[model samples]
Target: MYQFAITGLYQQVLGGEKLNQIEKTGELTSSRFTVRDFTELVKIGIVNSNTITAFTGMWLAFQLNGISFIQNVDVIFFTIVGSALIVAASGAFNNVIDRDIDGIMERTKNRPTMTGKISGKRALMVALVLGVVGTIMLFMTTWQAGVLGVIGVFLYVVVYSLYAKRKLVSNTVIGSFSGAVPPLIGWFAVEPSFSIVPIMLFLVMFCWQPPHFYAIAIKRKEEYAAAGIPMLPVVKGIERTKKSMFFWVILLTVLPFFMFDLGLVYVILATLLNIGWLALSIYGFKMDDSIKWAKWMFVYSLNYMTILFVAMVVISIFL
Candidate 1:
């Protein structure tokens, strides 16, 4: 029933002409659809990155709650795999929805959705299967985790992608909510309750996204402008975007203080990472070439997130 409903919605949104093009090209059954195309469509990088945070959240929950990891292998597996699949589904949905604008942006032009290597119907089907299965797995782990997963999908697909991306400059901020939910899902899967640790983890991820994505927006401002996407850098100019990044990075510095229970090592490491990011954010104002500075900021943000989450799991276990 759900499948039929989704197919109807796709048909309505895609219209007769686009559907005919897909059918006439026979791309769905063509040899053009490779494993690489599928991975790209689902954004494996995003899946892997979010899964790390989810796993970190679960591992920290186990340590904090005095639970044995060895005894709950099934729960861990479900939490991580479910989280990854949901995130991947979100990516696939984004690809399908953004296919038009994606073709305009150089960075996204070669994607399977934009290139028509994968049909809209096929991508939608993949997203539906992954989303339903992932949601079921999360529900098996804990209702809280399952609910968070659903909320995350709603925010990413309906709120951010459908509305905010084209209509609002605050789209990145709105999208951050979905990106931050993975860790919460992981924590709830293990503990099934609220706590400051998970909240801090959520804030850490939430704050990290703006600076990270704003940098990409800065580097690709012209492409985004041509695509008519209201990314911060595209809509608000580079200087304003830099100030926003600085603000978020500053907020990120304060979150580690609230996560003190993760120990002095985690706190100290997080503090240093925050300070480094903050320093880089400050440097952006003085740079002559905004693109070069944004690139630097982008690279640091990736390293900062990976290190911070890894520290959380490591400190929780060893300390």
Candidate 2:
């Protein structure tokens, strides 16, 4: 009688499995991303803390060139938002194109597209939305701002990402133009006219990129080689890349002397910053071809740019 009762109870429990399956079926759901995931995507999109420097530099340029713009919050909003979104769009689109190669490199192996967190098609769609919306914001500021914004996008996406990055050894040069345009967009959103100072701003950023990028290329040459991207260090050899870096460092050191309107403080500050950078570049060669030195130069370059631009803003305001 006990055995019979136990068997009956087990049969009832077996039937409860059907109810459990029904409950689970009702609870079925798709994967949902967390806040942290969106944050990572933003980082991948290049809309992180570092972008403050770029946006601030542009805003400072606008303020210095046209002080009245500081009173116009709408223009300020458009310039900051438009420039950032365009940068994000460019980075996302580049990630989409470089996904395959990115997966092969240790440095880029865990990018969203590589890790399947974001599909390439999805990334492309995101880029499109960002680009279009950013352009619209800039248009609200001024048509010239909108035009420069679109040109920046085209240069980064088409000229650099699609063409030069894969085919030409001068990819860094081509890419620098896109990087340099944000300040011009900021300046023109208010000034709406061409000036030598804005052109000098563009040239400063343009000259700053080659040595900065090549230092990174030197540090990661093996990864770049494995990915089959002809970064300067990979195609031209590290020694030659170092010499090229040195040449740019020297040019970067001197470019500030011409920005006379930025005043003597800017000239002195920029000169001191570049001299430190130049010292790093020369010290790297003297350090017996150390990758450590390349790594140091890479880190120093970040500080160099931020400080140099901060000096521009300070001199423009206080001096």
TM-score top scorer: 1
Tens-digit lDDT track of model 1 for 1-319: 4464356446533635654476576743344789999899899999999999999889989999999999999999999999999999999988877866776789998888666677777788899899999999999899999999999998898778777888999999999999999999999999999999999889989999999999999999999999899898877799999999999999999998998788888888999998899999999999999999999999999999988888787778776
**Model 2, span 184-205: residue lDDT tens:** 8877777788777778877888
- Candidate 2: minimum summed lDDT over ten consecutive residues — where? 6-15
Highest lDDT against the true fold, candidate: 1
Using all chains and alpha carbons, the TM-scores for the candidates as numbered come to 0.94, 0.85
Mark the regions of model 1 whose C-alpha exceeds 4 Å error after superposition. 1-31
Instruction: Give me the overall lDDT of model 1.
Output: 0.88
Error of 1 at 252 (Å): 0.5
lDDT of 1 at 34: 90
The lDDT, on a scale of 0 to 1, for candidate 2 is 0.73
Give every collision pair in model 2: none
After superposition, candidate 2 runs with Cα above 4 Å error: 1-62
